[model samples]
Target: MESYFRYDRMMPREYQRRIAENVIAKGNSLVILPTGLGKTAIALLVADKYLREGKRVLFLAPTKPLCEQHRKSFEELMKLEKGDVVLITGELNAEKRRGMWEAGRVIVATPQCVKNDLKKERMRLNFGLVVLDEVHRAVGNYAYTFVAEECRRSGLHLLGLTASPGSSKEKIEKMSELLGVKNIEIREETDEDVRKYVQPIEIRWETVEFPSEMDEIRKLLEQMIEERMEVLRKFEWIKAKNFRSLSKRVLMQVRERIERSSGGVKWMGLSQHAALMNLLHAHELLETQGASTFAEFFGRMEAKEKKSKAVMRILKDGRVKLALEKASQLKVDHPKLEKLRQIIETGKGKMYIVFVQYRDQVKKVVEELNKIPGVRAERFVGKREGVTQEEQKRTIERFRNGEFNVLVASSIGEEGLDIPAVDCVIFYEPIPSEIRNIQRRGRTARTRPGEVIILITKNTRDEAYYWVARSRERKMKRVVRGMQKMLQDRRKGAQSKLTEFV
Candidate 1:
């Protein structure tokens, strides 16, 4: 017989009901559910159980906006008084927050605020349960670690939630250890129980060929990178046989080696490698992003006062200058831009969110999108982009109300935001992280069927990134499955031990 609890508060789907029951029984759990699949619903169910027992619950999110968002959801779903569910953020003064902490039964706060409060002794770590949203960030010196440690010390029930933990096994292990996760519940979009609630997402890939002019500039940049690599080879700073085959990871390793070395030779090698990496990044931007992005980057480099001879050498090169000029005078927009325009055109009365990797692209994309009649577009960026939290809130509200048919956003739009379902999602370019790729795609196909269009530039870094994200997503699923299996086996072993004792 299937048992359900808290159905009166928020009617959860079958999978959510099962997962919540399991998590509540296990206590310390890491729940990995896809976006729009009701991870928050599970948290609410568990929170209700804790609240009924006259125990306080603390929900931690990564950002203030997410904290505020969760607060609203809790207020709406949970059968609690408006004052019982309180939001604590940096905006609140210490005294005011302390009062709220004492008064509120369910608290939604940014982890940093919780960490600060814990440090100041303004807030007690006596909660019966702590929910960490975006728990993949639990690793390292993030506030999630501090809060989790405090929770463990106080013997509080912990529930960590994320759409994607990460692709690396080491990162997953570290995050699990930090949260003291005793069980992991992972469900993919294709899971049998999950399929009913998952609206179908049609993923389309559109490939564009680089223009001949862009190719010429690419070759020039590659040549410059080769020259720098040659200098590094003379010093034996790098042992790679083919510079073209070298990856960003390999270059990062080289950087670590340079950091550890000493003397003038090390300094020279560092300067050369730095210049090479910059030029390579520029090459990638031109090939994958757009000439405008490449031009802006090169212009910044050119305008910045040079500190190293190697930087001066690359900036002063005739080929570099030629590439910059060519990029500035490009006769056409990037091919991806045209395809994006086409995708939007076909989706006429529908809403869309276009995800770009850079802030500058957000402006450029919004500008290009606004050129089309009936296409109202706006840029959504982070606080660093001069967008205040209030401004972000307003933008999302307007986007939700259909004041804008399209939202051109940076990576900020990818995680934990309450974005409305759209008819389509357009990836300005393929990202290399499976986590981001999943988040971007999660923005649509939420309430109904939706489409995803990925713009990939053939024979460029875009193609490579597309494959990298795909491969990582596959690996991540396998890793999550293994973790789930291990947790199940552990539970069974403990059960067997109890039976033997009986």
Candidate 2:
């Protein structure tokens, strides 16, 4: 309701105005605001300052769909001519892109396109400000790092934005360094200034217990993994005190070491490790996910030719064979699925987005939800899953226009996509990554109060994943705070040293 700038088009909230003012004044900033906190609005406000200085502004997103979304949002918010605002993509011919590069006052593009153009010398980096959305991806070999380096060389102001950088201090530091971020401005929903604007999100954890039959399958898989680990231990391949206590990280290291070995030993280790991994995956599918998912996975394995002797041995095991048969005979669905249906029924007229980790689960969820009368559901998956970008856009539009009450999606729905705000977000199963967990919860509680429901199977990997995400998120905040303080101390030291010289 309060307007801070001359551009009356966007009624800036108090927190947005403060954050934008700091970012613009600081010049190079990494804005770590939670999702639904109007991080984009802050970017726009800072960009408007650069534009008012008669300089071009370039906004970069990680994906074409996100780039298009930003372009549309800027168009709707800013009073600019069609030619003044351009959305650049690989689809644009070089000549047209060149012309747009010369004439456009504002450009929204994916980092890869900009990186390509820069590499080919097709376009010069002459922007006044470069805004990188989802900037946590700036680490490692991502195009964002290349593009940000170019922006820095061009003497352009850099603005990095993301909900969660990551759980590791090293990765966050790398992201900051790559983006030339001199200041870190982090805001959470619980922050005093942001609390008033944040809509309440009630979180619910729904837990289900695996049946005795599924427990039998889990025990068989555990025994098989232990047998494989013992073989590795006999070879001095794994030094871990107990195989049962070994984490996935240690298992991965063991697998890597086996990959580098030679001869019959290599084959033996590789095949056994592969079988162990597959069995672990099967255990997850059966315990955390449903019997149908496990049955489907087992069927796929059964249909494929035996690639490894260890896998063949696993298939031949009477316990595994019996477990597969029991999975096939599973008549009832996962309790989580039933719980999801009950949640949807409660929110009959409201919109919902159900986030699953697998494409098959997305399809299965859509199918099951559509079976209920008056519940319209559709599957939203990535382009890799055979759903084109255009179809994804259309699906989101249809969802926005109320054509579907529920959208079942894979990890594609977790980050940077322009998903419509829903009344609730249902996690089909708990995930271990803090970044993804935060992103999924962020799909709701934007403009109105919402709910986040996470389904976990008791005493399985679901519970482990749920706890890991929570602990990692807590650690991430501490790391960010420490980074911010370190930056502040460094700046103070430099200023004090300058004063001593004076």
Candidate 3:
């Protein structure tokens, strides 16, 4: 059946049409493509085909902003009347949502809203196809996981889409199993067919020297971490006292073990764990983030000392007092801030999205960037940080409209949001996760050629994180390709068996 819809603004690229055709032919398909390469375009094309077949389509994204973005695209791309499509989110009253669901031929929704609807038996999987954007999130207890399971049970056609599914084979396979998608379609920037559409993104590591003044702060925090780890080791909570072995993951396991117990020992371990975790965070601020960020963190801890015995104990420690004093007395900014100013001054990019890891740093980065003449920077953060949805939407719009040249955002800007393509993306610090690494880099190089500047603090976790994400991104491609081949072989075998039976 031919789709009643057409790309009225711009014609669909040849590769997008091919991928859409492939997904429609394959029963349930997962499409992995680099960001800005029109993954959503293929999704719309597939939705159109199903719509023309006289079946409804469900477009699922992770956030309300994303859902609204797709809703606009659905209306803009085709000749469908306004009543033919609708946006249903949890923000709407359940009764109104049900009405929209009944009236619209297509629904663009957030997974949480759909999950809630399903949980209350407000709706069934009545659609012919469910388009799962950011499909890699369909794992564990995520709302996406629940919706994917429901789609699987209904045996509806699934068109899963993502830029990065992560580098872990186990997690990817687990998500694949959850979505019940038996086929995979993967594309990379290097692929011959996709190369023409993918604008080249030049990723540069802008290494910055760690400030010498914060050395005492980091050293003191490391000593504190080691002391706590030693006690945990003695309690048999951990196998060894090696500080390197005490990653956040390992500490979380220790926390889990402590929570599962009930005794004086458990109480003691919890105290030690609490202090250790706080100290580790302080150390990270000293290393990866600047002195002002560390001071903000230390000040918060000092304020909490009145209520938390663990915090009180940490504050009373002699070394911690010295570290806090030193951080407060620091006169120089982290070298990365200077480097960032230089990048903006050079005018390499007219617009910039500076990806900061912490909210505290988001404010600091925006402050610093705006100090540069002709630079108008604003902080963009999450709802937990008190940035309402309307505020976030305005911030992105302001940045896009050139009201601000730089957008210093926390992790929230890395996913699902319909942020426009900037000329350059600045990573305030390297992230260890491949999924985020890809997403942050994808913010640039969207339509035209783009630049990615990563700020790496020398000899800190910044360098370590950069390498880890790079290695994992490479590994992800290999893992996805292997999964793709395995699925194709199995599919071919099934086809031959059916042919023989016929």
lDDT of every predicted structure (CA atoms): 0.86, 0.85, 0.86
Off by over 4 Å in 2: 1-6, 93-99, 239-248, 259-264, 302-319
Which candidate do you rate higher for lDDT, 1 or 2?
Answer: 1
What does candidate 3's lDDT look like per residue over 267-345, in tens digits?
Answer: 9889998988888788788888878888888788766636576888888899978877887788987888889889999
Off by over 4 Å in 1: 1-9, 241-245, 305-310
Q: Taking the candidates one at a time, how many backbone clashes does each contain?
A: 0, 0, 0
Worst 10 residues of 2 by lDDT: 1-10
Best by TM-score: 3
Badly placed stretches (over 4 Å) of model 3 are 240-242, 259-262
Candidate 3 lDDT score relative to the true structure: 0.86
RMSD of each: 2.4, 2.8, 1.8
Cα TM-score of candidate 1: 0.95
lDDT of 2 by residue, 278-363 (tens): 88787778777777888788778778874567667878888888877777776776788888888887779989999988776788
